[model samples]
Target: MILKTKITLALALMVSPVMSSFATTFTKEFERSDGIHKVKIDIYEESNADTKNSKITASEYVKDKKVWSLVDYVNKCPLDINMALIKDSFEIKKINGSFDAVLFSYTIGCVGGLDPVTVKYFAYENGMKHSLRGEERMVTPDGVIDDNVKPVPDANLKNNVLLFKYMTSNWNKASTVILE
Candidate 1:
């Protein structure tokens, strides 16, 4: 029994390092009302929890100068920020504050249906993150868009950045985003 236990432990240790490389975490921050907000995205190997990776991901928040009710993201490297990511729906989640009623979160599409992503923010007054506001022929990183039913943002995508910029800015004042 003692020998068997030692063997099992050895085997576990040997495989541990190999397991942690499959997960990833990505965070983006912006400002709203002069405050900072934060957005976090996590991607991992379906078979392993220890596998983690974090990189900067990008999506066109606006198309044809209009707001897309859907969320989109294209997996580039950890630094590139331009890519065409298609979207079928966006998962919206409401938090707190004045924007609570309409503010929500969601991601545009799936990682080819393998990786699921969700983005949340504040505003809208309905906490709706996936509702298509309207549809029209337009253009996006993915290509020429059709009547994509979405919302006419009372603000800009940069305004939407306020969704998480507040936190980043606050932290920066305390530590990094503003330190430099």
Candidate 2:
């Protein structure tokens, strides 16, 4: 409960501006051609996540059950860490139909997880945005961080992701992401 609350609070703080225009919410489902795979993603058209400016980087270490849950082949995973900007890849995938979401997957080849990742591409058919996670899904990337100490790789470590993302969860939610 605490962890979930923390995640929730942390997300609340990265607001740029409150948009009242897009209140409608919907879910879209997609299918894969490898024979059998159906993907369902909660979609909010014109979500506040789409409109915002962020210099803050938000990151979290992926480990233990958390990391394992994200990808099942956790044992052989090469990337010790992963991260993306709030509006970078994440938002672009939603805003533009240019590239399929399944193709943007960060990791590929690693196998055996709670769920096979199929989030790198998306295809719009039947009036719904649908994409399946290819073998190439990645949480972030394997990289080096020079904190001036023994540098240990960390996954899900987003940097300067947003302003409110730095503060404590309780404080973050109060930061309302603004467009300005």
Candidate-wise lDDT, in order = 0.33, 0.25
The sequence of per-residue lDDT tens digits that candidate 2 reaches over residues 77-110 is: 3322111211222221222333222211122222
lDDT by residue for model 1 (132-174), tens:
2212233345555333233333343334455434322322122
Taking all chains together, each candidate's TM-score versus the true structure is: 0.25, 0.16
Q: What is the lDDT of residue 30 in candidate 2?
A: 30
Residue 67 lDDT, candidate 2, scale 0-100: 9
- Where is model 1 more than 4 Å wrong at Cα? 1-21, 46-127, 131-180
> What CA RMSD would you report for each candidate?
14.7, 20.5
- lDDT for predicted candidate 2 compared with the true structure: 0.25
